[model samples]
Target: MSDREPEVVRRLSSYDVTRLDTAITVIQTRDPALARILKAERDVLRDHRNQLDAFATRMKFGSAAPWHPEGVMDWLIAQGWAPPKGLLMAEGEQEGQVDR
Candidate 1:
């Protein structure tokens, strides 16, 4: 058997899932490895989210917190990720029009 413990792998997997979920919710794109991990455990994560409120609750906090989607995106942009244009678009009904 390998010297590495199984618990270590479990913890890493949990951390990876959390990161992927945050990426999907905030950035709408998952890191390549994270995307693979998410795809492999998608069903399990969905079931867990449905059975417990933790995931949903955390999402609410992240969405409402001052340092959240925008903050994350800004930080990522600083790290070289391209800023998403949708982040700058206004919500709700549009007013006025621009002539070409």
Candidate 2:
């Protein structure tokens, strides 16, 4: 008989849910290449989230820090990984005229 242990899959933490959802959406509709990159990143994030959850579970009874849903989103935004939404001026450098 082999003594190999069974692999355990960790559940996604509350904080990770939003990021995963957003990533899935962006990947599905947008660039497949970017999606592949995001999938790899998501795997890493999932691992971190699992570790954090485990740590939180072990410490005391209820002393876990509140998860920031926008944390990853903000990071992606800052990296300019995706195009800007809402406001649009021009493709290149061009000052916009203020409408009053």
Candidate 3:
């Protein structure tokens, strides 16, 4: 690996990352095969986001952190790793919203 790897990756626009993130959501509820495809995509996106954040830090991009997926709970639930009904944020709530 060359030191230029990060510079090459830094070329990835925020929109590119955003599209990957959106794609994950779009396919998250589809057929098992499609959902499986997104699982790998999300992993790659997550790693890319991590690398971007590190690159930003090294370059002192700004006070703002680089973008990252904000769908941990949703992704986990979709993968059946988290409770289907939802996480028990409270006795009568799922993720802090009361179940109706």
What local lDDT score does residue 51 receive in model 2, on the 0 to 100 scale? 62
Residues 78-97 of candidate 1: C-alpha lDDT, one tens digit per residue: 54667567655466534464
- The top-ranked prediction according to lDDT is 2
Q: Which ten residues in a row have the lowest lDDT in candidate 3?
A: 65-74
Off by over 4 Å in 2: 1-17, 61-100
Error of 3 at 53 (Å): 2.1
lDDT of 1 at 92: 58
Tens digits of per-residue lDDT for model 2, 1-100 = 5566636645455667578668778676768877777777787877667665655554444334343333444444554547457444456645555556
lDDT of 3 by residue, 1-100 (tens): 4556654444555676577667767777776677677767667766767765764564454334433222433444454555646343546554445546
RMSD in angstroms, candidate 3?
14.9
* Per-prediction TM-score to the true structure, in the order listed: 0.23, 0.38, 0.37
lDDT score of residue 55 within candidate 1: 37
**lDDT assessment of candidate 2:** 0.60
Model 2 poorest 10 in a row by lDDT: 62-71
> What is the Å distance of residue 39 in model 3 from its true position?
2.8
